[model samples]
Target chain A: MTVIEKVSEHFRVMLGQKKEEHLGTITDLMIKRYALAIGDDNPLYSDREYARKRGYEDIIAPPNMVASIVDWSVGLKEEDLHEDGTPKTGGILPSNIQGIRVMGGGEMKKFINPIVAGTDVYVTTEVIDTHVKEGKKGPIAFLVIKNTFKDAKGKIYCISERTVIAR
Target chain B: MSNTQPLQVVYSEVEIGEELPILKKNTSPLQLFRYSAITWNTHRIHFDKEYALKEGYPNILVHSHLHGAFLTQLCTDWMGDRGELKSLEVNIKRFAIPGETLTCKGTVVEKKMVDGEGLVTIDLKEINEQAEVCAPGRAVIKLPLV
Candidate 1:
């Protein structure tokens, strides 16, 4: 089978598999750096004492913090990557889509609780669906990856889905 | 320090069909890198040209959420401190990469007094340097009419 065909068949098996990803912890420095990087000067995200005055226990990560956590937790370990040192998808996604370039489509995300520093989170990923459409280049495949985050106790925190296209 | 803008706008004075002050911000690779760092995004397409080319893109791509955040800022700046966003939905039509200046604009489309609460509909769009609508979105907000 061609590379694309092989990837497609592997995706079929991943349709409902529950993929586990352990995100270590949320750090204050990372949160501060992120807020600074975005040029957001909101005291709620950068100032701990100020944040407490505003009713938060401490500095909170921005709303899109989940995006970064996914990238870090999903990629293969550095030692297991390709010889070229390029990041590989591993079986995190379908094998057929091992090489397609995927972009972050917008997500419908809800912030259930504030993500404070030193919180260990776990994410469960699932392939929600896959479809093929004819594109200008030829045929393109669209895969939806849904990731659900939960605290150590298994209480759900947030859910996000990314739509990726493979050409 | 309290991050205060020059002026605060209350939702009461905003009229239906009115246009908010538009902002045109220029973006670059450095800015995108800072954003990626802040978001902890290492997609490679946002920073690595070689990786992007391998993925069929001519250059680095911007995160879809960044586009939405820009629009959200536009609305929040317009609402100032008194209004709260109820819902926001953005549909990505095209990609806006680094080195492209994007203009974010919005219009107050509908306004009504619903059961003692003031509601507003704002139509928002982000246009790239090429004048293409990269992300078209809408927001519903609850405002207090002065």
Candidate 2:
């Protein structure tokens, strides 16, 4: 199928196909590892005592760290797993345009609460919109998807809009 | 990565166009491993140099989250104890490979009040040694209204 044809087909199949999961609790290891990777020396992400002294109950994650909390075990819970987790049928990508290069075009987010270590992180993702534009070289697809992250109790921490571009 | 000056920021005392302290760090291959391990990102492009070469990159590419992390650090460093980051969104423009010195900078773009609380918006950027923009981001922060 042509790129346009494939994208149109995928769009219909993906409309409102929301996927969510209990990605498990946030751990100090996850927080500190992320902090260390970025070489951040902020105590709020490392020292529990320091965070408490600063008014947080536990070590709080850096705001942007929320994006890295996906369950990597390749063993997502049944409910959290989509009907087909394969790249061809899942997670926002349009199948049949396999040869195109994909890039993260941009992101927009709104944070409502802070996510602290030990709070179970949950994320729900779905397609909000999609647009096909003609680029300098050819047609490009901008897949706009929104992912909401919250603690297991349902208190939202943040909502992010990710724009994935395919050329 | 050892340490730096203490962070001290208050909303009312700050002004628009004020610049935050610059955050500079050299990314290493090992640091990339830690980032991938922590985030559970098994993408070969982040860690495998051969794969990167096949894709026409000079070296292993820095994870996009790493760029966002640096941008986030800049915002939090300015916020200090009296403020909190409300939101951050970044657009990755170029690939920052391991060992390049990346600098993060920000400027306060707007300040306002919501429900008796102070808020500030910042325009953020991360550039490589060559000074090319790698990731450009924006952040909204909530500050104490003392």
> Against the true structure, whose DockQ is highest?
2
Question: What DockQ does candidate 1 have relative to the true complex?
Answer: 0.37
Clashes found in each candidate (C-alpha, N, C closer than 3 A)? 3, 0
Docking quality of model 1: it rates as acceptable
What DockQ, between 0 and 1, does each candidate earn?
A: 0.37, 0.56
Worst 10 residues of 2 chain A by lDDT: A80-89
| Candidate 1 C-alpha lDDT tens digits along A65-139 | 664443564455666544323345553444224555455555555445657776778888888987767777666
Please, what are the lDDT tens digits per residue for candidate 2 over residues A76-104?
44454332222333445544355556667
Candidate 2 deviant stretches above 4 angstroms: A75-89, A94-97, B1-7
Candidate 2 lDDT over residue span B1-146, tens digit each = 22343546777887999998999978888999888778765556778788778878999988877888888888887787667788889999999999899999999999999988799899999999999999999998888765
Query: Which 10 consecutive positions of candidate 1 chain B have the poorest summed lDDT?
Result: B1-10
> In candidate 2, which residue pairs get closer than 3 Å at backbone N, Cα or C atoms, i.e. clash?
none
lDDT at position A78, candidate 1: 63
lDDT of 2: 0.78
